[model samples]
Target: MSLKVLSALDVARIQLYHFKAIIIAGMGLFTDAYDLFCIPPIIKLIGRIYYVEEKQYRTTPTVVVSALVAIALLGTVVGQLVFGRLGDRIGRRSVYGLSLGIMVLSSIACGFSICRTRNCVLVSLGFFRFLLGVGIGGDYPLSATIMSEFANKKTRGAFIAAVFSMQGFGILVSSVVTMVVCKIFEATSHVSNGQIPEQVDIAWRLILMVGAIPAAMTYYWRMMMPETARYTALVEQNVLQAAMDMEKVLDIPMSQIAEDSLLPSYPPPSYPLLSKRFFRRHGYDLFSCAASWFLVDVVFYSSNLFQSQTYHRFIKDQPDVNAYELAFRVARFQAILAICSTIPGYWVTVYFIDRIGRVKIQMIGFFFMAMVYFAIGIPYKYFWSEKIGIGFITLYALTFFFCNFGPNTTTFIVPAELFPARFRSTCHGISGAVGKVGAIIGTVGFLWASRIPNNNGKPDPVRMTVALVFLGVVCLVGLAVTYFFTRETMGRSLEDNENDDE
Candidate 1:
């Protein structure tokens, strides 16, 4: 009976409800990207506001910057483990709205973080952002699993990719928002002797607050979404309700689904995650997904979070620019990069993911990522020159392109498809949690490794070259894992992917 009910979902035609599911789930990811990526452009502004030294604004202490950025990532690891398990234990719908609720509240709180002392303000912002990260973390497994379970097998990859693609838009929008806010402030405020204007403080707060809008808008729709037919039938053992839910969503007759629920029921497999049978079947796939996600994020987040520092290295030295001007320049560059490379890469994946299969796309993406990183790193000084900076930026943009088109999309897609319904959310959560660990490594490790105080607080040429080489090596490792460990899940049903029906 469970197989029959699931088959109905697997073979169903793409419909309006499918698109609805994509938007409802996709918006959470949009908010996730906005909240996560938006901070990099504003970190300097925050430092200027609070971390003043001898009446001169100092570069935010490396430790303080890492904590500000990495605290949320740390919270993400915890959220993924806890909320991921809860998603499987409770119904997806029951806890779905709760995560969004946390996001809405926390985003607002982060913007309003104000205290008497610098430490108090920093701690308050970090605390709220941690809660924001928790909410963002919950969305990963929940959104990916829900979209995978709701989609037809033929377009499952595309559907899930579509949901993930919202991330690109979120990133682009954050850049745009930061750029626009900076431009607004730049016109009204003036800097003298390099001191930041008071209005700069308000700008960062507004930018943080804006992330709440989309998440808040989608909360009602997310609450209205029904539990996936697979979870309802396979996990909840509720064939009749599953059938009824499908009948409504698929706009099919009750007659079509009613016949399946009446069929004889069979018990589902009850192996725990630790059993040898479980390891024998899924251990390598989990390793591949986790490792690939881990590796990709280490490179991706390091580059993404500190892109401003990277840009400053290549641009002509401007002796007269203020903090707002510096931020505007960085945000503008990032927005352009997103438009030219990042956003397009995601849509291209959406277009080809179902057609080419996930494994090929991932391997191809990892391969090109390595090639591009090497291209930039090998002739480090040649590309670093101000005259040829465009060449370096082009190569840098390609990494973002291939990442979104490659492992970034597939890692999220494959984990949801590779596991059984009972463990789908849990496994994907573990995978995503591991990925966040990689993000923390990237954010903290690369920030420390790349910054050299001896180089007037700029990234040292040798260290930057080494960092690029390391990322390239990580990509090569990802490519090997994709080839050896992951399986293709293009046209297979979830049960078929896991051999669950047998």
Candidate 2:
């Protein structure tokens, strides 16, 4: 088999295998999003169960809240760097199932977060969450690289975007599941005077445990997938294996296979990531991807992972609500927001990503998010006020819509499409890891920043002004970066994306 044949197959029209690859890869993302986002509600339960008596359930100390939110991000940074490089060294199919397995086990363990002491419970939950993050992080580079390698050039962006769009569904499902579970516990448990019962703990545990289901379900199919043909041929230099595998995937007859003699004889490129050849050719591309993803996530994760906190701003004056009530209300509202805005935005991207071009959609999405978020920030006090709280919720929902439609989806799509096969997973991992770093900063920093004090030492009305303004600026910077550094990958062959000779 030859490089040209593989490239031709890559750009060929879509096939059944493309959808298979999407389902196989997309399920992992669904599990990833469900596991990652589900943590917030569970953390709310943790606050209610463990900290409510301290009069700080809803107002858990910033440090404690930050730890719960940021630990998984730390693990993901490590996982992306580790699994990504390992995928290149070994093979994608070989190590692919490991991440899902980890996610399953860790998610279950996270549900059993109980311990002999309160301190032990925190340690146990945090440790499992971190491990879960590692698994979810591994899926990022692997899923993107696999889907990009499998997709046809004509619709590669849409395919990969569709895979990522499962994230929107996953998030929506998490909200729905949380709502149903909360309602079930409420209906079944013996509640006196509206006090939350011990059965409430079971609800949180069940919610956390459910994340393992989808991941475990997909593990078999994931392992059954052959190594992506690009990795087999380009990185491993096993043209025969690559040809046979792709033959099955594309249903190409043996008669169509290229002869080994005609294949390129040059050795696979093996430069270190920091080598001059790599730096000169792909350095700017690498930095742009990492920085843009980082900037988008800073706002993205903060808004998403801490969404209940944002919702609290609208209904904070509700008097005498217990922690479980607050948790249920937050999950219900989050579900509504996701159904109405988040899921729609993701589907719109899936519909138009290939048509509009990646660069244009991203820039437009960022611009709209920046403007809306800025508008929300400028009148922070007014929106937080009871008279205009609905107005604030409307504006807040728009940011989520644009985020899914724009940088959030585009950032994930581009890294998989823009880099060489050998370094594709590694580069994507680095970009993803950097994005998680920003997520950590966003989540932890926003927790503290949103609590800025006024002259009287009470929290100020303009507290969100600084954070939203910073996010809006970051989106603008993302727009500029996308314009200058990222090329549109609407119809380009993955091989064409490489800067080096075959």
Candidate 3:
């Protein structure tokens, strides 16, 4: 009958709780990024162990190798949808720890990817990684929704972006870890030529198993987190409990918030996403988030995950070299680029997201990404040339910077803020799921397209060029949608956005 009152959390000054929430939530993403990107290098290592060793000169088929890499995205897609809905229905904290536990167990299993044959080993690895993906996917909606709900409106964008920025560190760490492990193997293995043979199989396993340590470390902390006050108050309609939870989280006195007579009563919502009421309000928001995320991921995952393959393709025709040498080169390039460009771009978003607005950053990021991709595509031969390859590499690195500074960061931030508290996790999950689908498309499609045969049945640079151009077009389209349809949520309370839906 009356307006609902804001709690200490909704309008509270930025404080310690916000940073703790960011670190806890961000750590999940850090683990997610590490697990997801770690697979790419291992994919190369596996190929060397099986295909190249057996055939003496041949690599694995593109489709087979792509499946090994992209299967986790499929798992993540299903995980986001399932866990996201469960978080909304049951509660965020109830389902949150379970996801991390799944990740811990699955990461350990992924390390033990052994079987009687190469095909069997690949299958086992894919299966365990899919299970690991299920955990990583759940973290997306849970972490974003948790951070958004826990944060004050004034710094909410930067807080959420800060959590997502952990992804850059995850990626950087994965690369550094891979390089370190490779170097260690080279030192320890008795090979005189500095080649790490099957002895380095231990490296991939160690890398994957190490991912479990971080997830395990965070389990107690995630479980200790109180359910978000927003969900408790809005969806559960328990203002007293919500107030009590906020009091604990914010260290505020409860006597001030205990008066229930002033709080408005909310009937439970029954708005299905397809219903007219829901469609009229959030349909465009959902469409925009899902579509823009979809486009960004296709390029992001394809480029990041298969970076090694891109390098390998350039040298495919050169004189034969040991696979370990090739893997080292790929890891070194990826690590340097991630450290220099990718990680910084993410923090740039964190530093300015609340200040510049999310949609604007996304637009600028998409525009520059398109320009960079096109720059590489049109001069494909020139950039690929030994004389100017460094320039091309620089441009390629810029795409990573733009991706972090652009749609990749904003898409994750906006969905968590745009939806009603009742459906926040669900909508974020939907958008994240769509993005993973884009990742699958990018990974599979790019791998297939890059290998399309010419009249001579060799790797076609022209086809690869077309793929790069397509990435540029996708970014332009996303940029348009973002500029036209995406609403900015800067400096606004979550309740403000929720009230708009009513």
Best by lDDT: 1
Output the better candidate (2/3) by TM-score: 2
Tens-place lDDT per residue, model 2, 6-53, is: 766765777888887888788767877787666666666666666656
On a 0 to 1 TM-score scale, where does candidate 2 land against the true structure?
Answer: 0.93
**Candidate 1 local lDDT, residue 466:** 80
Using all chains and alpha carbons, the TM-scores for the candidates as numbered come to 0.94, 0.93, 0.93
lDDT (CA) per prediction: 0.83, 0.79, 0.81
**Root mean square deviation (Cα) for candidate 3:** 2.6
Between candidates 1 and 3, the one scoring higher on lDDT is 1
Q: Per-residue lDDT of 106-185 in model 3, one digit per residue for the tens?
A: 99998898763687888998899899889999999999999999887888899999999999888878877887877777
Could you tell me the lDDT of residue 247 within candidate 1? 80
Order of models, best TM-score first: 1, 2, 3
RMSD of 2: 2.4
lDDT of 1 by residue, 1-502 (tens): 3366677777888899999888899988898889877876677677667767786665566677778778998878887877788888897788889988998999999988976367887899999989988998898889999999999899999999999999988988888888888888887786563766778888888999998998899999998888988888778877788888888778767766665335436466877874887877788778888998999989888877657656766433253467777677667777788899989999999999989999999999999999988887777745563234677778888999999999999999999999888888888999999998999999877777665644365566677778888889999999998899888999999987875543
